[model samples]
Target chain A: MALKGWKELPIGGVIDEPGKSREFKTGNWRVLRPVVNLDKCTHCMLCWLYCPDMAIEITVNEKGKPQMLGFNYDYCKGCGLCADVCPVHVIDMKPETEFLKD
Target chain B: MLTNIDLKKAQAVTGAEAVANAMRQIEPHVVAAYPITPQTPIVEYFAKFVADGVVRTEMIPVESEHSAMSAVVGAASAGARAMTATSANGLALMHEIVYIAASLRLPIVMPVVNRALSGPINIHCDHSDAMAERDSGWIQLYAESNQEAYDLTILAVKLAENENVRLPVMVNLDGFIISHGVEPVEFLPDEKVKEFIGELKPVYPLLDTEHPVTYGPLDLYDYYFEHKRQQIEAMRYARKVFPKVAEEFYAISGRKYDFVEPYRMEDAEYVMVALGSTNSTIKYVVDWMREEGHKVGLLKIWMFRPFPKEQVQQYLNGRKAVVVLDRSTSFGAEAPLYEAVKSALYEASARPQMGSYVYGLGGRDILPEHIRQAFEDAIEGNLLADEQRYLGLRE
Candidate 1:
């Protein structure tokens, strides 16, 4: 969409549409990416609970048990909070360039 | 389209009471205020009205001026008609949020009882407090009398809430001089005032669940500049809309108003420019000087924020000399009002020789003799080499 002129913007810096923060794509600012080792993961969910950006996604298995699905890189800012809180040491902060090379 | 058939009778009251009465009639959704000298009575009166159920307003007696302004911003952003009152140091305390309120384009109406900014702890009438926030992007309307104070308070709400001018407004009255002095003020009936202001239509209220909106967000270089440009556009729009709003107000109250009130300017060679209550003294001096065969006049500024440059030039051009009286000093530079008047006539083909007189700082008394001396000095070209003079100061 073409950006409106300053005169066309709403008063008070109001964003008329709701839930549009998803469009910001803060992941572009990330220098590092979170990498998870599923086999070593204890399923403690501490990383999921402690993720500041809410970037950690949790999934369920066929037996109806919750499982960690690693970070959602689209919105993750790579702050390393999830890795810091992972007791099992399954999550590692890797440079985005290294991950892309692999 | 208003007729006097529903106009209410006049009452004797102080400027503070007049503003409080106007607020009660407007019945805004929220008024979050913290009191300081001179302005305290305004909020106190309004709070009593709220308590007595004379008006059903959510009166938040906030602990500090910062919180008071913050609450007003939040309420206004939520799409409610919100207001507050303050004076002097109280205004200084709320300086940060005051800028935010205007930048957010919230139509909050604040009654600023003008008092001297203190170091020696003076609590008296001066323009220092209002002058401090002159560049905060709020529309400023200075009242010269209690009647104008009452009238402008009502008009400020309409001006601020105008869709084209969605900016906060500060209705300024001189501390103690107008705020505490009792004068006769005619009021529009409650229904007429209600009808005149009409309904406040918020563009994108935060309370609207289905269409949620962000109030204030972090906008850096790319968007911040554009937003500020939008605010400038709104201020320009206000300059155009103010007269029309005043016209509507006149229809109701039979009292006419303008951005600049030029008294006896036509055929006058020397004129003095001033703002706030000092205009009354200048006008009196002008009358006395005229009777003595002096071609003198007074130009009173009612609207200061948008700085009606064109109107100023129109009245001041071709004059022999113009003297600007400022109640506050700019310290190392020219006084604020003087700077504005000089710049307004800088490029005029027939620019007048202008001088500045800084007077009434820290509530120093400005007698009619001081005004007479200012006019005489300007007429005789006895102004300081720098063209700035101090009035009523002991050597």
Candidate 2:
């Protein structure tokens, strides 16, 4: 991103626009990524409710009912509280190295 | 519009109560402060105002000194006109947040009652506490009396909230001496204070739902320095913007102040520089020595943080002798005010033979005879740059 001069930038590093936090990706900081199996998943939304960063993405399927789509890797600091909160025990925390090795 | 039929009456109150009265008059949106000695009375008095329904300020009785500052920072960020008060240990505890308050450009008006920083635990008057945060980017105004304390607290709010100078301001009054001692302080009426304070008009406040802004955001190496550069520029702008705010304050109260106040220095051959409540005692010495035909005067540092460089140089330049007194010792340093005075006169055409005195620490009584000795030393050329003297300490 192009940087603004001190005078050009707003005072106190306050991001003036909403959702500007999305620009700064935190997924890189994640060592453990939460992965879920859609086959056994009950879509209880507990993991969605428990995610600290709001990294769990929710959307509507063909039936138009809200369903847990997947993790929004753009954020998702990989705290693993989301996987722990899932009652069905289908979600798992995997090492980032597994994906990087691919 | 100055309202109320009865106003401008000087009330007999201590510096703490006077400041609380000013806070009452300003009626800020929030006051998040923890109680501490000397400074506790300020919040207590203001709390009374809150209880009586005199003002509708959201007074947050914070758990700790750190939380007190944090609460104000949060409130200020949310577009509320916020203020806080603290003393020695309390001010020290809020150290981390103090810098954040300035860097974040929150216009928090805090009145600090100057007390001795603990070291074996002593609670009395000294500049040690406020001096610790001298470089914290807040504009520090030291008051010599209750009236100035009252007036400066009001001026600080106006100066801090200025668009060009969105920095926190610390108004200092001497602990016990000024904080507890009663003096007649002229106060502005509530409507007049409201008119003068006007509105807070915070920049991109979090409370504004339409304009969502993220405060205290993370900026890495790419932009951290530049953000600090903005704080630097804002402080420099405050030096220029202060007089305009003081001008507005003067119009209502007929009281005006400057960075440095020179008392009887017009034709003086010997002069001394000092700050806080000590100036009141120093002035008495200035008056006494004037009668004896020795041309002696005092340059009281009204504003400490900015250091009032030019005015200090302008006042002390070409004088035969200059004595700088600090209530707080820098431990190994040459002392904060003394070092500043010397640096100010570094580029001047002529320099005065200087003397540095570290006096009145931990609330030691500064006697006239002791003040007389400093001036007499200046007269006799006994003062040396390297040899720093201590008043009231038998060594």
Candidate 3:
């Protein structure tokens, strides 16, 4: 539906509050975290199968036995598909907000 | 009669009416449009205003959405406030000129009534129509409610016309939900809208006779792709200018909105991610679930073209489970929204488990319980969507 009339936008300043020391780069914080459970994990590759970013990598043990995969968190935005599709309920969500205050 | 309301007065109106009023206030020099479902009444009302001398803008009746967008692109390049509206297949048809409008930095504002993209033809809302043109270079803004549709239209004009961001902007509204539904809308005074917009100043106008700059000059591969690279830089400016513009809008209107809205998400453990009308329903469900002590929230994506990557990464960072509600299917691949959110989370170190549900395809009404079911699915580790589970399908 349509909203009410137009609102005026003030030009020239980026900071909203008057006395804020820390300028926040809102994009720096991660929203979603994935944790892997080595016990319940199956070597079945479903998490790697559907990963759009190819963030998950499957590793094998020294004895060549199938082992659980690991994820690259550098570019991950915390969308938990790897955790979601893990046949074994091996991965869980850990939010990133616990550390970042802003 | 022109009904004058408070500058800060907030109310809900149909998407069509909201867009029409926004156009009236913007005072476009030319409004070229072809009547299409959902977007038809918007132009119709604007036509009436022009006929009755209520609005002093030239309302040009065009044969197609392509022509409508083309006419506005040309007019805008020549330094005129130009705007139009279209829906579904009509937007798809205007695909050719849409990219050109952005590449040339033509600040034309168009309201696209989000409808299902066709094959086995459907004429209702989903998001396939808008999502289909995601890469068209236009700054995409998805509106959940009517008020957002209207306010975003104004913001679209302001943002698109900004010196830093001279790309075209498309304010998307769901077909029936916002287009047909009417509510009490406070129409801003023409003087106030003019005041807000100020005078139109074209930086490198096409019509400048004294300092003539070539319009659409042919370039070889050497400079051709670089021109497109400049367009990318302008889009980066669009991402930054969106929140800056929103902050200014909040200052005057007292209504604040972000590129992506996070609702009751401070301590939310379970979240549903979607866009358009579905967000409204999701919000209601989130509120209900919240009262019952279930930690649930909703993230309504308003800006899609620039993708608001940084903002989304921050807002959705700490949730336990994220259920991406994809309204449109990506055929054999995962849904588009689902893919974007999933990728963003993957980039962040701290991310939650992401589950996807392909619901509300072909105009199906996604309900509150369906969202609850998705939440349950996320919690119980039911990742794959069940074929039989449809939200508001007609039996």
Please tell me which predicted candidate would have the highest DockQ against the true structure. Answer: 2
Estimate the TM-score of every prediction.
0.91, 0.85, 0.75
Which stretches of candidate 1 lie above 4 Å from their native place?
A1-4, A35-49, A57-71, A82-102, B1-9
Residue B282 in model 3: shift from native, Å?
Answer: 0.7
DockQ of 2: 0.65
Docking verdict class for candidate 2: medium
The Cα local distance difference test for each model comes to 0.90, 0.89, 0.76
Which segments of candidate 3 are over 4 A away from where they belong? A1-102, B1-12, B384-395
For model 3, the DockQ equals 0.01
Q: Cα lDDT for residue B289, model 2?
A: 90
lDDT tens readout by residue for model 1, B200-319: 998787888888788788887657888899899999999999999999998988888899998898889999999999998888899999999999998999999999999999999999
What value does the lDDT take at residue A74 in candidate 2? 84
Candidate 1 lDDT: 0.90
CAPRI accuracy category, model 1: medium
lDDT of 2 by residue, B1-395 (tens): 01221244767788888999999988999999999998989999999999999999999998999999999999999999999999999999999999999989999999999999998678899989999999998999999888888889989989999999999999999998999998877677788988998988888888889898888877798789999999889888888987788788878987767888888989998999999888888899999999989999999999887667888889989999999999998888799999999888887789999999999999999999999999999999999987789999988
Error of 1 at B214 (Å): 2.8
Q: Tell me the tens digit of each residue's lDDT in model 3 across A1-102.
A: 222111221111111233332222222345867778767777787887777765676777899876556776654556788888877788888777664574
Which sequence of candidate numbers ranks them by TM-score, best first? 1, 2, 3
